[model samples]
Target: MHQQGAQAYQQTANVVASSRERESALLMKAAAGLQKIKDEWPDSYDDLKPALTFNRKLWTIFAASVTREDSPLPHDVRENVANLCIFIMNQTREVLLEPRPEKLEVLVRLNRQIASGLRGM
Candidate 1:
């Protein structure tokens, strides 16, 4: 019984780690997309809409997960995540309205930082 329990725990841990890694990779990809838009702005303005929309969708999913009553995260962490999601939504709206290259920097930085944090965890 003890051995089986240990094995199950290890399996769960591995699954969680894999999920985190995937999430980090996705975040990095999104950030890279934003960076590409910034590098090729004006010509890339059309691309900005899709990239920003993708990120908004991703953050919305995360916000939903973290805010769930059954979420495993601590209350404070969940609250913080919810708040960050709100900020992301607002920022995304601003970027969508203006579609400026400089505005993308904030989204890029946020994605990279969040990805880094996810990777560390």
Candidate 2:
């Protein structure tokens, strides 16, 4: 029975082999958008709300996916991801309240790092 279960898991894993890559790409895309806003500074200020909105929505989806009972990730990993999402939510709130360009650094860094990890880096 155990062997059969292990085999099933392996089969499913292969079926979703590109999920990690897709996740990584999405993260990178979000990071790049945020970075552009950061790099352009006051001139790009008009884009802040939209960029942040995109990132927040992306992270929210990730949070929901990780918390699902059907998620294949280990429990500890899911918990860690949830905690990170919480931090992201808090940081995003701070950015919205203060509206500082420098305040976006952490969000940009976290997104890139998470994306790298997803790529097995």
Candidate 3:
């Protein structure tokens, strides 16, 4: 019984580690996509729509996750994340409408910061 309990705990830990890794990867990917736009700037104005769309979708998923009743994050943390998501959504809309290279910096910074936070976790 003791060995079985140890095995179960190990399995649970592995699953959690795997989930965090995947989350980190996804955040990195989003940050990279934003960075590409930053690198190209006005020269890649055409890419803005798709990049912003992708980011919006990503934030939407995050908002949904954080808002869920089953979310494991502390209440204040969840609230803060949800608020950030709302801000991201609004900012994304502005970027979409204006499509300015300079405007993308905020998005890039936010994604990298979030990715860093995830990695820290």
Candidate 4:
């Protein structure tokens, strides 16, 4: 029954989620993951690398997509997204270097804010 319900939810999500919605979901998921690590602090320090890597990769893809020549986003919007993605990548690198709980704050906030914007919230 659980498996069936999970499948149903996946199907519904695939049908109803637009690109922006999907992006928002991914960002929120990333933010949640990072926040968990932050909340856990030293205990979750070992989880930091994997979380940061996931976020960095996500931002990299977003940067590439926005910067692509055929991207449908407006020039200024694309540029802005690309810039934000770059900052995310850099911040991820810093967190990786220091592994401080406080360093995770900006990443979490940015991801949540970006997700909210994507959802038009």
lDDT accuracy of residue 28 in candidate 3: 75
Best by TM-score: 1
Which stretches in model 4 have alpha-carbon errors above 4 Å?
Answer: 1-17
Superior by lDDT: candidate 1 or candidate 4 = 1
Error of 4 at 54 (Å): 0.8
Kindly indicate the candidate among 1 and 3 with the higher lDDT: 1
**Candidate 4 backbone collisions, by pair:** none
The whole-model lDDT of each prediction reads: 0.91, 0.92, 0.83, 0.89
lDDT of 1 at 20: 87
For every candidate in turn, the CA RMSD to the true structure comes to 0.8, 3.1, 1.5, 8.0
- Deviation in Å, model 1, residue 114 alpha carbon: 0.9
Q: After superposition, how far is residue 20 of candidate 2 from its true place, in Å?
A: 0.9
Off by over 4 Å in 3: none
Model 3, 1-121: lDDT tens digits are 9999999999998887787777777777877887888788768777778877878888898899999999988999999999999999998888877777777788888887887777777
Following a full C-alpha superposition, what root-mean-square deviation does model 2 have from the true structure?
3.1
| Model 1: per-residue Cα lDDT over 1-121, one tens digit each | 9999999999999999998898899999999999999999889987988999889988999899998889999999999889988998999999887777999888899989989998899
lDDT of 4 by residue, 1-121 (tens): 9999999999876665587798899999999999999999999988889888888888989998988899978999999999998899888888877778999999999999999998883
Score candidate 1 by lDDT.
0.91
Q: What pairs collide in candidate 1?
A: none
Q: In candidate 1, how many Å is residue 34 off? A: 0.7
